[model samples]
Target chain A: MSQALLFYFFAAVAVLSALGVVFHPRPARALLCLVVTMFALAVHFTLLGAYFVAMAHLIVYAGAVLVLFLFVIMLQGAGAREIALHQRFNIIYLLPAGLVSILLAGGLIALIRGSAFQALKSVDGTAENIGTLLFSQYLLPFEWTSLLILLGVFAAIALAKKDAA
Target chain B: MIPATHYLILSVTLFSIGILGVLIRRNILLILLSIELMLNAANLNLIAGSAMHGRLDGQLSAFFVMVVAAAEVTIGLAIAVLLFRQKNSVDTHEIKELKG
Candidate 1:
């Protein structure tokens, strides 16, 4: 019972804050809302019993990713006026986008409702189990991810580098 | 324990909201944030499936998704910064060179 309550509470937080991220005018504020949504999702991961995943979610997303977002938003001064102006002209796209999203959600939910999910015992998401799987079954992909991150770092630097005038 | 279906529904809702944000938002930064939302929603689905099936594979997949998301965001924000530097604004409508 308590688990359900907690799940509902965090789910509400996640949804509301996600909406904030979308609709908030100021980029900084929207980034803050996204952080909130990330934290809420982290909690959901915990509730689902993926302990290592929950921690990774918190550290990777709420910690590293959101801080990066904050730095970018701060570097660029908030542009409320520009956003307001854009919002005025972009109202035409709003209704159609909202309708499309609603239809997609509805269709997915109906499909999920029709499927019969087996009630298997929940898996243990301990670090030990994940580590074993990572080093054994997933070693190749794990090594590849390091390469991906290294490439990402180089790309970011190359793209964001200042030109010598 | 909450049913996995409920979690799936939540993920779907979150994903849809992300789609809405990506479609309607004019700010490039906000579009990136929306993309993060969608990725997180997918992560939730994977974890839920993992819990439902009592397997570690789904969790591993979610972990990979996080890695890819981090890489994508790094490149994406760098591009956003580049766009801001060249254009002086992050508004999508301001960039029309690609319209042709």
Candidate 2:
């Protein structure tokens, strides 16, 4: 019972914060909402027994990536006023929006009705298990990921560096 | 007990919101943020499915997803910074010229 409650709570918060990320007028405010969504999803990860992933989500997403986003927002001096919102509603867009929402709802229903979700397994996806798997069958991908990070670092530096006139 | 369906539904909901953000927002930074949100939704699905199947593969994939997200964010923000410097604005509509 409690687990269900927690799931509902986190899910609600995640969805709401995600909406805020989409609709918030200011970029900085939207970034905050994005942080909240990440935190809520981390809690969900924890509940699902992915403790290591939960922590990484918090650290890498809320900590590092979001900090970069905030820094860029600050560097750009708080957004241009004209671009705060891109869409002005027209009567024509209403039909597409409604259709998309309906399709999304149908997808949700199909997901819930699937047989794979009928049983709840209480498995522990602990960090130790993940680490074991990471080193064993997943070792190749693990090494590749580190190399990708290295490439990303160099790419970021090259991309962001100012050019001489 | 919370079934896996609940988590899946949540993931879909979050993904839809991210899609909305990407579609509606003009600020390139916000669009990147939306992309992150979508990636997190995918991570949530991986973790939940891992729990459901009694396997660590889902969690392992989530780990990889995080690594990819970090790399993408690094490069994306760097581009955003460069765009701001060159164009003086980060509006998606404004940076139309390819030469810059």
Candidate 3:
């Protein structure tokens, strides 16, 4: 009963913050909403028995990616008037988008509910078990992740570098 | 105990919200953030499935997805910064020079 309640609470927060991310007029505030959404997701990860992923989500997403978003917004001086979102208030566009989104979501939920996934066993999902799997069965992807990060760091620096004449 | 279908329903809702954000929002940064939300929804699915199946593969994939998300955000923000420097605005509609 408690688990079900927790899921409902976090899911509501996540969905609301996600709405704020898209519909909020101010970019900075929208970014904060995005952070809230990420934290809520991290909690969901914890509830679902993925502790390691929960911590990683908090660190990488709520910690790093959202901070990057704030940094850029601050540096760019995204003013209230400039990012006012007045121009994007077209009902014609929103009406169709809303209709399609509802249709898609309804169809998806129906399909998933109808599927048979009840007999599956639950895993421990402890950090040690994930670590062991990372080293043994998923070693190749682990190394590739490191290389991908290295490339990203370089690419970010190069892209944000002040152009030299 | 919460059933897996509940989690799946939440994931689907979040994913739809992300899609709406990407489709309707004009600010590139918000659009990117929406994309992150969508990715997070996907991660939630992977973790939930992993928990249900008694397997580690879903968590492993979620780990990799996080890595790629971090990288994608870095590169995307860098480009957003570059765009701001040249254009002085990050509104998607303002960027029309690239359209052929």
Residue lDDT tens for model 2, A38-143: 8998888888888888998899989988988998897798642333233421235445655776798797787666654556566676778778888999999999
lDDT tens digits, residue span B1-100, model 3? 6778788888988988888888888778878888999999999999888878878799889999999999999899888888888888887878898899
For model 1, the superposed segments whose C-alpha errors exceed 4 Å read A79-82, A85-89
Q: Please identify which of the two predictions, 2 or 3, would achieve the higher DockQ against the true structure.
A: 3
Q: Per lDDT, what order, best first?
A: 1, 3, 2
List model 2 lDDT by residue over B2-92, tens digit each: 8677777778778777767666667788889989988988888888888888788888899998999899989998888888888997776
Q: What is the DockQ (computed on Cα atoms) for candidate 2?
A: 0.63
lDDT of 1 at A47: 77
* Fnat of candidates, each listed: 0.75, 0.74, 0.74
RMSD of 3: 2.1
Off by over 4 Å in 3: A79-82, A88-96, A99-103, A119-121
Candidate closer to the true structure by TM-score (higher is better), 2 or 3: 3
What TM-score does chain A reach in every model?
A: 0.87, 0.83, 0.85
Candidate 2 clashing pairs, residues 3+ apart or interchain: none
DockQ of each: 0.73, 0.63, 0.70
Q: Best-fitting candidate, measured by TM-score?
A: 1
